[model samples]
Target: MQRANEALQTQVTELTHGKTDHQGSDRHTTTTVVNFQPFSQEIAEEEIPEHVKTLALDSYSGSSDPKEHLVYFNTRMVIAGVNDAVKCKLLPSTFRKSAMTWFTTLPPGSNADFTEFSTRFLSHFSTSRSVQATITAFLTVIQRENESIKSYMTRFNELSVYLEDSVPSVCVAAFKNGLREGRLNGNLKRHQETSMVEIRARARSYILEEEDNRQKQKRDGTTSLKGATHLGPASKFNQAKTNRPGPYQARLSTRPSAPKPLKVVNAAEASKETGTAGMNATCGGTMLNAPVSDILKEATCL
Candidate 1:
């Protein structure tokens, strides 16, 4: 029994070390491949993430065959921490019965493997390579008049992916050249070509700076408009008037009120004259002297 056990252990070790089937031309070598970190991210839960559904749905293009967009949608799955098993299982639930019937018709034994399924899917639908188209798009990327840096960068990155053999420096230069003429673009032009990392850092800085400027402008505009409604040409006219005083008002405000002359009074003389003459006639005949203000008031009244 011990000798039999020893023989079994020897056979096991030989098999583990890949025993040669024959010598020379007929010698066979078995390859043992190690699968290290198969999953991109740790997927602790059994159920797939809900974002996977959204991603698949969003990426699934109706115009193209299912095979044409599988790669595109698969990228999102990889990023979402899904393994091949989970991806295979969860992907079908996203499709309708009519659409899924195509997958049902796949060759026998092909349904078990993800790689096989992908190959079959792509083979069923002809997807021509887009290297030339991608190149054209990359070369023609340009920043629009008021396009955001993020949007421009996103477009640039997407296009750059097509230039598979392009150097990082060349890609960065292409991106810089596509930017609109402004502070950020000028900085990129004057900047020394270092690396894609540094270029992206500068781009991020410019984006933040632009965002701050936009927010400030929005706040200022809101504050000014909050004071009154924007009345087109009339608003401009009102604003100009409010900003500067009217010519007539300014002229009148500077000039002082005109003074009126006081009436000449002779009370003592009138009294002496009245003492000799008949008192009633003298007093009644003389006119009473009035103050300038009172005279002006009387004139105004008249």
Candidate 2:
């Protein structure tokens, strides 16, 4: 029984190591190969298309959005008519630098399918997901002071395209509120229930009216200036003549007149003999002292 047990142990030892040669000088050794691929054995062994290898795809690094890269990759694969296994094989071609390094670090055969691979890839680079803009972010979209209504609308619409859930009424309100206060703003506000189509029509009409008014003002100014410039010498002469003073008031003295000289009148005084005769006539001595002729002359003088 002891000898049989010894023979069985020797057989087990030879099997554990390797088969010995007939001369016991050489051994037949077996080597085990580990598959380091992240994909299952079936996917790794799958034959890749020659056209797929030649096809140029957009490369991705750690910096850009990982999900976007996957989307683009999947789209290209679908167009190429490749299966999920080919897709898994071709994904590494799109990776570069850090992305390639991350791919190399994945556990061997950890991803059994394309879905599992994509899930793992997204999980690792989850921080790279794009953050969507909220409704409140639209509050910062204001019209510039010098910007025209058309320019403001274009800018507003450009931003609104990114906001998928934006309300039409809120956007309209924002547009109206952002406008600089003027006739256009007042007109828009007066019709609060107006739709976007109506608003555009009104804006178009307002813009056209403004342009027309500006053109009219320019034409009037130009006409007046031309009329003034072309005034003939004869017209100037007529204007000068009209401005002159009339005949009655022409060449009037500007200074005060000198005073008039006073005049004196001379009269002859009564003679002394006449005065004596008059005195004698008044008294009783006048009859004796005066002759009849003298008395008559004196009486006449008196």
Number of the predicted model whose TM-score against the real structure is largest? 1
lDDT of 1 by residue, 1-302 (tens): 99999999999988866644343223222221122222223221345657665653543322355554786668767778777767766655555544465554544334554676566555543322334455566678987756777778888876565343345666777787788777777888787865656777887887787666655545444323211222123345545656776899899899889998765545455657657444332333343464555545545444
Q: Looking at model 2, report the run of 10 residues with the lowest lDDT sum.
A: 262-271
**Which stretches of model 1 miss by more than 4 angstroms?**
1-68, 71-131, 162-166, 222-302
Q: lDDT (CA) for every model shown? A: 0.58, 0.65
TM-score of candidate 1 to 2 decimals: 0.39
Kindly list the per-residue Cα lDDT of model 2 for residues 1-302, writing each as its tens digit.
99999999999998866644533433222211233578799998999999888998999886676777889999999999999999898898888888888988897888778999998887665433222342454577676764556666667766454332334576677677677777788888788744455667788876666455545535443223211222223344555765778775664644457887533211111224234333433333234234677556656665
Candidate 1: clashing pairs of residues: none
Runs in model 2 with CA error above 4 Å? 1-35, 128-302
Residue 148 of model 2, lDDT score: 51
Q: What clash count does candidate 2 reach?
A: 0
